[model samples]
Target: MSDWEDEAEEPSAGKQRPRAPASTPWMPPQSHKQRSYREEGGDQPPTRERAWEPRGQREGDRGGFRRPEERSWSSRELPRQPETVTGGGWSRDFRRQEANRELASAPLCFRLDSSVVGTVIGRGGSKIRELEESSGSRIKITKGDYDSEVKIFGSSEQQDKAKTMIDDLLERYDERPETDTRFGYKEIRPSRSADMSTTVTAPVKRGINWASLRENREKYEIMKWADLPPMEKNFYKEASNIASMSQDEVTRWRKDNNNIICDDLKEGQKRPIPNPIRNFRDAFDHFPEIMSTIKKVGFDRPTPIQSQAWPIVLQGIDLIGIAQTGTGKTLAYLLPGFIHLDLQPLPKNERLGPGMLVLAPTRELALQVKAECSKYTYKGFKSICIYGGGDRKGQINVVTKGVDIVIATPGRLNDLQMNNFINLKSITYLVLDEADRMLDMGFEPQIMKILIDIRPDRQTIMTSATWPDGVRRLAKSYLKDPLMVYVGTLDLAAVNTVEQRVFIIPEEEKRAFTLHFIDSLKPKDKVLIFVGKKIIVDDLASDFSLQGIAVQSLHGNREQCDREQALDDFKKGIVRILVATDLASRGLDVHDITHVFNFDFPRNIEEYVHRIGRTGRAGRTGESVTLVTRKDWKVASELISILERANQEVPEELFEMAERYKHFKIKKDSERDMIPRQGRWRDNP
Candidate 1:
């Protein structure tokens, strides 16, 4: 089982490089004329009959005249050769030397298969180096528009020697069967190439591309824990299963199951996991001035996301953080900024622009970042929160004064940048918080435009609860050599402490069912309801108010001041029930939400996670109920797949309906809005 194997010859295999062009002349030079064939055979030997006459026939003086086949080294005696060599290296092939000289002047070229170029490079051109050394020729491998090839050139003798070595290399290279490599797998080859016609032989393998594998290794590593092959189906299935399991359940399962997996996919064998945190604590501790600033803010222990990410960021590597909401992403980037800032200080008067820019999806989330930043704002280090909806005059004033960090929403930040209220060119560190939400909200273009205004050499960091396509693409463009940190998959529902349940109800009884669900809530149980439309929000809020339940509505249609009031009241528990549309589903940071009621099922499963995420904050347990109508039964079942992946329990009734009508589509009138008509309800009242 040799690791080096030439791929089997097959019609599907890619074409190989052509043979090296033949050198025109193959003869010795005037300097070495004595060794030339012409010099040795200038005078022909005598005829065999005459030479073998009498004495030779009788005594073997005719040794040279023996049968051609009998001229064996073992049987023949040594000849008395001349002591001195022939004269002046007898007549050389001056023409051959002239041809070699001309050929060496021309560019030496040989084309190889593009596919095997990587294998030939062999970790910093080691394989290529070996080839050049063996062939006694200077080599240059180049990739261009048409394909890739290698070129060699040297003195006439050296080039000829190189040509022979290349032929042998290609012969050995072409013998092995083609095998694709998975990530980190290594193999060897007898020679650089197998095809004698071309020097393009290299062992290749079929598996994950290194870039893709490196980007998604955080996820793939988990799959390896299950001892599954590196397939998409395997990754998704295991990710879902792992996502659904509780921490305790996963722990117990690992102890009992023989095939339990970890992030790197090591089974039976423990993997060499790197230190989760770089010396961030040491960095903070060594810089007492910064430590004083951090300690004053109650920075005792690093959060899970912080523990994994800060060290990598401080190490100045890129990062892909994969933690859920409320995991303290602010500190993850903030700690690194502080460490970097403390180490490299700037003059006070010169701090007119932000050193770090943290972009959040919404004003509230941006404000939240600023608030978190405040805790660490000691010893002249400060951050300003900037977003629309508030007084711009004040925001401008704050920006004008200069701050160490600026936490902002994309649109507002752009507005300020356009107005010349802030200078983005000075930004050294960039952070995109809740990247999935920003992208989902259609802030990508503005985010990109803002990034374009800043320095390209800046350190960029992005945090997201979900790894959506938009976020992934943005990460590719913005970050360089990022260290990916994935705590869990995005669609894992009710993470930490929220019990997700669904109730199947008829469409006609939807409102009544919601009322019943709300009535069941105990006193002071803060509940958040997620609705699809703005009209439903108003109707639901009215319905709850009339029902003697303290509630308020928050949606995009409302005036900015009014929306703020509603959110503020909800946060204060002044209104225990806050009915909101999708706007609040993402960056609304009210931690006291005890229950989240999906008065209507979300349009998609990802929305479902965001809705439920509002509750279950700060280690407090929360509960969520999805009021599913007959029309939603099918979608509910599809939704259960996500829940099951998150390891949440699905209601049996919902599952049963899905099982019965798996192929069925729920029919509904286009006009059947979740928000009931106001006239009839008001007239009845």
Candidate 2:
């Protein structure tokens, strides 16, 4: 007689079923017409009643339905649907039901592997949210266990839709550049407590504390030249002088100076290492195969660095050759590496493995260096680049097989070392090209570790444009009293080929000013824009692209693929303006660059030289424009010193601002009763 008792009741139209109240009552329904009619129709009386029902309620029942003892449903509020809507215009309630149904029916859960989940989620989970909306299904990632599993829930049809969506997403995810998401092992303090099992603490106490650490650290410390001791001071001064001294100056210095040690000639040698390649002219020069390979790669004439470094490297002299970028630095070391390998066969011992170790700061540079090595590696000389951003297992396998030359970045090399894949004991020639930049990027410590791992007696070549303090210290520590062949502070005057200029603009108008400059970039003129920050590189790149400018950006933040593409695009002249950070300014040789713009001035004076040096390269006439704003006057002043030393004229506006700031500085100094240095602006400006 009751709806609860009518479980087997037949449906009449789609009419609502009448039932007892949710709560228990003392009496049954007062209106018995409807129920008595059902009783007259021979419906059986209720066989069971709620246990909490009162006696009066049972008597008043007259076989009518009584309220149940269970909690009432009418007072309870219905659940609110999720705010998110599906792509197919399904309401949140319908979507939730559909998701539940899908989860119930789904045959198997698909998994996606990623070390980074939070990054994939992005801000506000917009990426996943967008995917859900477009797929007409609900996709829910499980709780953050760092597990790769993601749940796709919807109805069977919606589940199928979600699966397809998920599959497509996985494909895109796989196609996306792999991010370096390694947070590394957590640092845990060593604990003696047996109960503290979670902590993996190691006791690192030493007899000496801060002072000892400082003293020991300084023992092997590679500081800038200025921080070196008085006795070690002259070594760098001599090195700087050697670097600055021209080829003729070097010839004179080596002739007169006996205290300096020449790696090849010893104390009294007059000439660079004798050309070993000349003796094997029949093997390399006259031989049609080697000749063709050389010709095809465009080795018409040897560069100064190449000419000097090759013979010494070939002769097995531990020479340190300092040279500017694009001056054949790769070949300076690569040819030596090749010649060294060419002269001798690999030892039978497996430990006597790779003969060459060339370290660069970037994967692109590593790969590029390896590419150069490949050109001359025809005679069973195999070289491989062990760099990140690619398949590491393949590189590991190559290392296992042994290579003639191994070019790699510090981090990947460190990784290889951690995995026990790299054996540097056999490396005979260690070349650190772009040494200064390598030191600048905090690679010195890892590089030192790598050097220490290798045979110390191995030939070491540390090459750079201007030897910074860090580089000098690294050279002093790692390199023996090595042949320090420096090409001196490579100023614009030293490189007469590059023409430079400056444009004074306010700080606020930089983007617009950059846009105007980009518009002026002609088709054959490759342009590189240097920014101080990585984010600005991205922002300007995006802004330029949105304005229909086919520009590419290169920075440390970009994926390796993106960075490569930007470089390729610039190389191909498809993208005229390359927005980049200071990282790209060094060790990158794009000869066709006609314009270099300092979208932001460099942090140091040396970087400005390199950034502008990218243009007017390989003896081509080029232009560099630096937008000097009022705020950048301090940097501008430092830059002017280098320019002045190089005989390049500083902009008149910069000079005037330097003078004005000098007056203001003097005024402030006087107001504070501090005596300012005399002839400051006048001395320079």
Candidate 3:
């Protein structure tokens, strides 16, 4: 009979059934003599088949072979025990137990709402599986009567990591809008009440509590009035009353100082706007060092912008100073900034970064602010200027060392901020100097990016030569309850100290007119020639250099070092003429700039005002001569308005050119209206 038939036979009452052949084909067929030897329990070499057999089964066991129905359910389902050696050696089961003990940790459990449980688990449980793999833990979800309990089993580190990931996932789901399929529409969920509480055993009854999260996660405390030290609070209180002028007194003071305007004051909600300070002593009475610095710098009295801006800023109010350039707007903000830095509750050592920040539009302006900062040092505070084309690594090094003030151009500051090279969390005072110029240069996006890192409650002071729509939008977005202080009328106008002259000449005669005007300048005159293009600046600068005139050029194409040198030479009177583009139109502060020659009309009238205001600084009389051609007719009306506002002569030729352009524009619009609409031309009878 075959071995299969023999194994299938039933055994007699007392006799055991014969064993079957090994199922694996790799085992050679055993001879009858070997089978008889194994059946008699004779010692023989162990085969691969015997090594894999279940423990406690002997070769002669009568019940080793049985039908499937005879096996118990538990015996079939349970895992086979690991084989144990008869000698004194560690078993596989012992090692597994030891590993389990080492990895054992208390399971972390959290409850999620039944509605959001699917979101956490994802389809096919892929998200939960991914979380388990990434966090090195085993996650199990058990649906209870009220909510689903998520339990994580792993080491303590793994459990914490899993918990954090789950919390983040829950937060994202909480932010999503709730949808109801039965209603077939999306509805806004009402905010949870403050008194509502979350139970440990129940689902998160409310959305993620952001206030609680912030309290647990914030690394630093935001500065506020209640957090101020006793001494700093007392100092601010005393300084608040230093203005000492009543509302009537303030009105009279503002009127006397060129009708200085203050707007957007919250009448009853806050303290009354402080009065204008006549002298440095009035505002800086508590800080003798500041007063001494002002005296040392020989500032007899504050300018119009500074006079009103001082009280508002020193009172810790956000300000939008709409003053023309060169009206001491820099000092107006800088002096108050120094006091603000000094009066902060946190000391310099405790601050994460600089306490004050000044954002300028150009490298030249940034350096100028730095120079001003150097002149008025307080309590050994240090300031750094960061801009493109400078030593970036050196700037980073200086910042790492420590700085109390940072004056930077927006581009380089944004670069540093994105790369995490600078921290703005500690900035309590910020100055957007030349804000309109910054917007004109297309730095608004970069400025917005840099401001994202700064604490929102920081006091901001924005100074613009002209308040254009872009600047207004930026101010509205960033400033809170800001007070406005403008030196002159809010409408665009040049400084009154400059004599404005306009000559209507052909575009071809502009260079000759500029040359003739240069010839008329006295030996003591310092002229700033403004052109529209970089090529013009270079071409005119080259022509003047050939004529043996002491001249330098300033434009964006020039290297930063060369630009700085040119500006320095111009400021020190080493060069009598500095031909530049509108780059120098704003924040080019040279007290001796006696002449501004506009060789080419600016793109807009606002730039024209800024170009002329560069001269006539610090109560000094200066002259600006503009050469307007046919190409500049569009802006003639604005030019006329600006000239009239400044009480300067409005040339008859300018008015005629403006009238001609107006008539031409009206005719063009009429012709455009008469044209048939697209796709409707055939319908026109």
Candidate 4:
């Protein structure tokens, strides 16, 4: 595992740069002979055929990464490699070398052979001094300092010219055969670039290329976790019970397990996983720090999504993991992501955009991911969580310094990028944390724009509870050879981890049933109550407070600080009941929560499933109780389907009500219409 690896000529395992010819300064008297950056001797025997891996950042950089396969290194035979021209990106084929005064400066180092080191730092360091002035960059002449490595530090253009100068200087002094490097340099290679057109593009539109995303999913590369090599596999090896299940047995198991059905999956040109891991340790064996962090977080095993996603991501493959909410989906990516970081640890003080970018849909989820990052964080690793409602200047200050990982919502990440306050050129890993929600909330334009900023060669990981047509289309555009993983049933079935109940009550008496249910909850247990609208969340929290219940409500409009505090209070057991709108539905992982109450049913099954997912996490048994009224009848059937999926008993009346409202649909009117047709749906009423 060398500290550095060469970049891709083809779209290799992950986005890494070609061992670019060091930018040159001298013209050869004759047209120059050339060679690959790694092939120093044209006729020399090839060094052991190397496993392709992620590129390492230069010393003092804070953004480096390596995957599992690339961690082997022989320190004795190595020289410090200069940073690649493209920063191991997938965005563009080559650097435009545009004089965008905004691109920050960094020190570049090239290790010189011991023999010619004296020639470059000639009499009294005069040659090195002269080279620096000509290139308009600072050149440090490290006299016998391996760490210094004849370093050139400054803006990108200056570094390019400086490298060229060094190459020429070396050529002039050494009569030895021209080795692995070229007497020539190539401009950056070609890759996808942002077109930057304002007009709507076909690929960015919803459901535009679903045919590709909807093809057979089973055709993807599938490998068993038990079958991997000693270095590649997890430490704990028990043959998977899943492997023994026949295709029919798998379907039967999924019927009760609340996992994605093979039938529901349509891999968007699946990047095959020859051997996907099924445990937490195998996917994260590269680094001890990550292993320590996982234990601190108390995650004993891999969730369904984690097991399948680990190997593909470990190999630097792009991924789209579609799993139900609260299945440790966050950790599935984060832990293995740690292994990737270990594979190519960033330099101590990197001064560019983060190598890893995680785009979450909501602010809460972003904060949650940030918290998880803290728990599993490595000592050299740095990250910033940015979203709206936070201090913009504060976030900007963090971005200017550079980071290893960025956890952000689409809008904020895009805005910072647009304002030129942040850079994405060097990013090697990109994650669409909740791809479905981002698209559903009309973030395609922002997401597409962010996609362009990243190197086109970066590894992309997208996760969602439901794989909608639009998200699939978005996946096809950004991800290349992504392994699509389904953890739970792709349908919006409630997680089988929680027990479910439906209580049919009249609209006016619904509050009584809710009160009765609340009274029945154990005194110490935490509960989450969901309402459809933001105002109702506030109203219910207020009413429940009067009823002597300790409750806090959350929604989109609250200040970021308030939402953070509320969630903290709930998780700390200060608040036993937290009421909220759909904002709290997707990813609120409070392990002690014992129940979920849908006071007002959601607009869709996806919302309902996510709402209840607030409870029943980390192997905790929990319950979901829905008070079904005539107003809820229309979509009541969705609840029945999910209940059936979880093998729960669906009350007969629920089916009757679903059919009754099957022909009924809500209508818009100038006057506020009430759910009960009496209590109007507004604050004034």
Candidate closest to the true structure, highest lDDT: 3
- Candidate 3 worst ten-residue window by lDDT: 181-190
User: By descending lDDT, how would the candidates be arranged?
Assistant: 3, 4, 1, 2
Q: Give the true-structure RMSD of model 2.
A: 19.9
Between prediction 1 and prediction 4, which has the larger TM-score? 4
- Candidate lDDT (C-alpha), each: 0.63, 0.62, 0.76, 0.66
TM-score per prediction, in order, is 0.55, 0.57, 0.67, 0.58
Instruction: List, residue by residue over 137-157, the lDDT tens digit for candidate 4.
Output: 656544443222344555667
Expressed as tens digits, the lDDT of each residue in 132-182 for candidate 2 is 667655665533343444445544566567556544544464565433221
| lDDT score of residue 122 within candidate 1 | 46
Residue lDDT tens for model 3, 520-615: 889999999998999989998899889998899999999988999999998888989999998898778899989898998898888898899988
Off by over 4 Å in 2: 1-292, 345-352, 488-494, 644-649, 660-685
lDDT score, residue 356, model 3?
89
Cα lDDT of candidate 3 equals 0.76
Q: What lDDT score is found at residue 69 in candidate 2?
A: 55
The pairs that clash in candidate 2 are: 26-57, 98-154, 98-155, 99-154, 102-154, 190-201, 224-469, 243-486, 243-488, 244-488
For model 2, the run of ten residues with the poorest summed lDDT:
229-238
Please list all clashing residue pairs in model 3, or write none if there are none: none
Question: In candidate 4, what residue range of length 10 has the lowest lDDT sum?
Answer: 196-205
